[model samples]
Target: MRVSSIYVDGYRRLTSQKINFEDGTTILAGANNSGKTSLIDLLRVVLGGDGNLRAEDLSASARFDWLMSLVDAAIEGEDCFRALLEDENVFEKVPSVVVRIEVGYDPDTDDIRQFADYLMDLDSEKSSFYFEFRFSSKRDGMIAAFSGLYSDIRKAVDDCNWRSANDAEPGSSVFLVLQAKVDAALVNCSKPEVFFSDESYSNVLPMSTDKSFKRLFNFRAVKASRALDDTSDDKSGELNQRLIAVAKEDKNWEGVISKLPSRVVEAIHDLDIRKLTTDETLRSLNTVIESISSTNGAKQNDLFLDFHVTEDHAVQMIARAMQTRYLGAGVPLSEASQGLGYSNLIFLHLEAESFIRSAAQEENRYLVNLVVLEEPESHMHPQMQSAFIKHLLSRVNEIGCLQAAVTTHSSEIVRLSGIEQLRVLKSEEAGCRIVDLRKFHTEEIADKPAETQRLFSFLYAINFSDLLFADRVIMYEGDTERMYFQALIKAHEELAGLRAQYISYIHVGGAYAHIYKPLVVDTLRLKTVIITDLDYEKESNLSSFEKLKPLLSTNATLNEFFQDGKKNSPPSVADLSSAISADTGVALVPDTELAAVAFQMQPEGYARTLEEAILATLLDAPVWTSLTKKKWKTFRNESGLKFSIPREPESPTITQIVASTSNQKTDFMYSLILNSNLVEAVPPYILSALRWLDS
Candidate 1:
């Protein structure tokens, strides 16, 4: 049997979230504070973890409602309060942390008797059972005790108010004191309850105990803050203790233990320690001790010292002296001297081995084994992080019933794990939303197979999984645009807030920028700005000397953006340029508020690409003169080519100069950034896009 899915409600940030699991492994990935840890904690608690639920474990709204329910019940008098406390269906009415686990099994193969009592569904084809765990008040007089405490506090507050109003005495502080007492009493009465039920939870089976639930599922976790250090005396000592426990469990170690005493005694005898006692210095010391005893009138009480090595003592000594050492460096070094990364990796392997061994034991075997690894990428380099998931999966595959769930923030691990195994947790004001990418792709892109294939291929080729964790995204055309935008964001003060935000810049180019619309806007719901060039083509093969009348955009993204029911026809260049120049290129993505597109344009006319647009923008700035001088010196010195420097910014010679450097756009942009500050030379369209993203 395996856990197919988990539905959590009213648990710390997870108000009403359901997470689906892969049969083998599920990668829970999201940004910090997105309820990844809360989900893990929920799993642990529901699966018989020893942690007790406190008031803080409830969500902010749940906690408020719970307290308000008690307060309202108190205001209605003792009879109403008693009724509310005794109601068996109180959990359904009040907001409390509840988790429903759905476990799927093959009736033909699995042990039916283990989960026979939990089978609420009658259909033979149905292979899943549900178990609900919830927080509730203790029923054995604890509820009555809590009720009495709350009622007493309510009466005390009423009397205090009456006294203050009648006598004008200082009785206002009495309410705060009584409220603290009630809050403490509530914490003392809270407990967790477990029940068997159907999928919708309308049909609940007989009450279940925590021990029975523990027998069904086994859960273990490797927490993110492992506190793994080299000091053997610290928490690292747990490693030694675990080694000892595993060694004692092995049957072969019985014979080794029986022979240890004899081996220790034989080795000690070979050391010849009695020779030290026979030395002249020891003899003189013994003679002095005897004379002192005689002078004190002690006839047969002379004290003497001797060296002894009992077998039991030697065996105990050897056992306590055990230590871990690294022997690959030709000489052994203590574990304390090794690096933290290797130490953590070793610790992880040992933990997995221990859990596996425990689960495989005959008496401790469980129906399902769950091993959760939180932030396994800690202290690991990129290469190691990328490979750790596969290594862990291979190790856990030994047990056919085992399932591993890894929670990570590393993009390398996410990229390697693939989207099919991902459960992305997104934080919202109400709680969290868990997005299963497998279902998302199947439902959202079910009709568009070609686009689906193109999307996955593009994602895999660029390894753009890091965008999954960004606050927003900026998709640009090429390397030159990426380089210039990065430099500009860093150099300009107006864009300083963009630096604080986590923005992922992706190079999608003009042809495939539209391909990411579904994922960026629909799945991730990210605020996205796609910057593409308006590649204008000549109207009718006009001669270079003659003026070009009309132009058309060749960019697929812009064409699709402005496609007005026209087939095989791109948007006119004049219309696109007009929108860009007027700062009207921003359009909300269909059914989304966070995504838009920005294309290149010049105020007076159409500029073909980012390179031309930047040059045209810089024509009126002083930096343009500096760039011309630098371009002249660079070409003359590096290529031994002579060219006339353009004196007038509007001259056709300047346009020729911009066109000449098209082949080396990246290198030219790099040189331009290194020599001149282009903060004032930012193109209008690009500036609008950046400011929109910043806002």
Candidate 2:
């Protein structure tokens, strides 16, 4: 239903290229001279356009002459052309225009094939068009079928004989013809239809330009009707009379009369000019008739009327002019007048929106169909441009039109829009290359559309526009309680407000935080400390976070931590090999270990005693109680006690379990923290840092 994709082949500053479109809103962005116009021109050509891009269709002499303007005709030989085409050291002059594409759709139809129903899904390998810059499949089957036939013919030329072309299969041409018929059933071969809101349309309409209202006079007028066989003006006039007589059946001059100003209405009732002797009387009569004719017979040539604005109306006109003049636009958005630097931008945008809206139907109004705006947002304001983009996007609902392939170099626009639909148009090789955003994939947190887009763009700086990482990031909790509790801890502790400026916290979007973690870890190297409720894993002896291993394996040290430990729920921490108990009743040391103990005790679990284990790991008591006045609950919550390495909390958190209260709980917390091989991993300073530095 929308302009789903675009294809460009062998065009200026562009090589063969193809772009796939998203179902909803899509934006195409790039740097200056990055081939934006090349993209637009390619679209124009593929849509059967003329003018600048129509250069390819010119005669050989014309092509050569034009080429000579930019280069010495001698150097513009086959080698130069070859270098251009191969884009290596020379250009190659290929016989055909070269851009390829695949369009996606929802309700597939013949006129424009919805992208979803392609003959070969883009993933199919047999189609060189999948990765090659040679195939261009438009939603319009006419373009696709014709291109397919051309490709087939080219294959045949390379194969055996002309008649043996792959497209020459029985009835293939006929099938294509039928498909063409289906495509034409509703849509046209010219530019696709675009819909817009009334406000969007009025912005572009230059009605206010002609204060005399004579421009509307220049519009299509109805003088008289012509009959197919009539020859004389008289006969034509008679026929026109007949036409009007017939049309009068539905005409409502009375309605127009009612809509006129009351003074005009009264003047109409007294148009017997003989009773009006003064200049004012004549003026009133003229004004009334003008108003009547303007409203009525609007389609007739004689119906065009002029208006005289009095001082009273000047205020309204001036107000409107000021608003339009001052309107602002850009990324770091502001008001149009002061913030915007260019003039006429607002008007130009209004014009384009109107043009698009006029052709749009009520149902298809939202879809941003193909926009042909020519640098409309160029002037007026930078902030206005940014605001314009957000305003445009915020209003774009599904019912809105498809994508906008704009020609822009506004950095603000690029930043605000992210880069999902960002297509980099580049002139390379003999032709242009379009880097379709859909073609880019990233390792950043792909779970979020915005995040994925942001990270994709971020990584692209170090990488591509594919947002693999962002300079700024926000972390959300799957549970709101965790955010609340984490906030509580921050408020009570040393890191208060510090974590916020560097790393922001957020509430989870929904019940299941099934966001793709692989994507997050791959790009950002996020140190996520998931404070999940210790729910039992379906499989016992495994940790509740078992799903997190392969993802965590990227970190060697963290990998070792989970690997050496037993699989567990809250109970698993106690199951670890290092902890010991004084007797069966209690395993002392730290409150951080309480959650795991509670799980074990509630399940009627008890630790296995080992007298050798006592010698196995030495003991201590109440060493943590000496420093700060703190309840076990407050201490555990504010400064969480994970089996932190003895080091200060730098890359990984550190928690040093003191000797237990009764020499028992000491072993419990210890078992969770120390790895047997890395027992010496705990540094001396690390042990001291684990002591409450400020508390």
Candidate 3:
């Protein structure tokens, strides 16, 4: 049976919190001091702890207030306060911690069910059972207290709705419902002095140090700091020591050691120098022993310094190196380059796995095999972090019927391990809060509306796992925009901080950018900024272009494009560009009524596209002239030095010049930022969007 969930209360910051687990690997991720370590410690205590709860395990914030108040109330000798003391008496519950675990078993797995039944005292009818273990100073007293109230307990037991306890089986009720209630009521009693004897706790069953319950549950924890620390050959290396002990204990090693030759007693007898050199000192002692002896046997015995041989002292490592080359060229494990430390730790885990597999080969295969890891990504770079988790998990599963759980703060761990396996802990005013990402995903979307499911499906197909690493996200349209935006953001000092934050720029394009709204806003709960063009598909009013072309056509430098018959009639650029240039002219119109209808066919109205948005930003006459001449030099001018556009800017003249030289809007924006004075000319909406995302 697997531990489906852990309910920890009255221990450190884990004041009444439940963390759920899956059969496979579950990743615990959270900020520092959010009780990630506390939860791991609680698991170690409840599942495999050796003794009763310690005083230091009491909640830090609640300890001082509780003890001081208890002292005050006892000194004052207030009976009423004692009567209502269950809610306030901190010392009574200070050393008391409760860990309740829900053991889940599959119906097909009879062995697991039988194992759970053996540990939890559950019948076959119960597919799942919660074993509540209370570790406290009053543990032994509580059992005695319940026996004292057995008459009242029997009456309550008869009155209890037995059907409620056996809801699954209807008629089977073998569990002690009476004892459970008596245990609860006595512990919940106001006066601890009257209810419980003043005694230190003796180890309790299932949660105690005894191996009786290990047939069902076992835990192995790899600490978070293991990655940075080197594995020593001394006593400080716990993992190393554990594996070495296991190797020494194996029957194969025992059999092999038994075959080795040893010195016979006859051969050692020849070296009895004690008899040859100590005759003077032993003569008087032998005479006294002969007179005082009561034994009938005539043999005499003398004490002397003795020595025996042991495998550890006899066998030694003459040479050791990691063979990494084809012909056995070696490097010492301690001095190996690349990811040797991480690789070595994984090797130790594999050795531990060998011991576990050996245990499974015996009759204890029903026992839970668990591997608990804390921050396995410590010294790992991003790539190594991803590779290590993948390999660790794959190897963990290779050992039959094993479960793994990892606690990490690495974004690579969160992303590569799969979002569904995440168990997020948040420290709140109430207590430590745990969110099982798997449970939330399953429950929230199982019966969602069809439209909502469709959006979820789209997101699932693309996978937002990568975005889990980003602090904030920028959603833009197409490849060209992504390219230029990166360059633009890098060029500007105001937006440069985004690189450090790992701000992700996602190219969802115009049509699909809105599809991510629910994912960003609801699911992932990320801070996101969407930059898309307000696009329209109608033709520009040729009259607006027609009106401005001739007026500016008189200038000799712009004659090729804007000169009446010489230029293309519909405008050389696309319809959206044509509409934006026309709209700029319309904004200059004296009457508001005429200007409104002038660009009516534009898709997103005024400034409907990126080209339109940038064009609408008023630029200095000199800046505009310089940008147009540069665009011509880059895209149209043959000799690279030749300029076909004018060197001076007029409102309509600059508009026509830009429309002639620039084909794509992204190209135009890139050229504009690079050549012109962009600080005074970037559109307010664009800058505001960037600033808001940065904030």
Which lDDT values do the candidates have, in the order given?
A: 0.69, 0.34, 0.52
- How big is the positional error of residue 438 in model 2, measured in Å on the Cα after superposition? 2.6
Tens digits of per-residue lDDT for model 1 on 300-408? 4434445455545644564567777779759997767766777777777777766676667654453777888888888888887766777877776657667889998
- The positional error of residue 182 in candidate 2, measured at the CA in angstroms, is 40
**Residue range with the least summed lDDT across 10 consecutive positions in model 3:** 192-201
How would the candidate models be sorted by lDDT, starting from the highest? 1, 3, 2
Of 1 and 3, the candidate ranking higher by TM-score: 1
RMSD of each: 7.7, 22.1, 15.6
Model 2, span 444-537: residue lDDT tens = 3345588656744454343232222122223222342333334333443333443343332323232222232333232233322222221222
- Alpha-carbon runs more than 4 Å astray in model 1: 65-93, 137-189, 231-235, 245-319, 364-366, 444-455, 540-551, 566-569, 574-585, 602-605, 620-656
Most accurate candidate by TM-score: 1
Using lDDT as the yardstick, the better of models 1 and 3 is 1
lDDT, candidate 1, equals 0.69
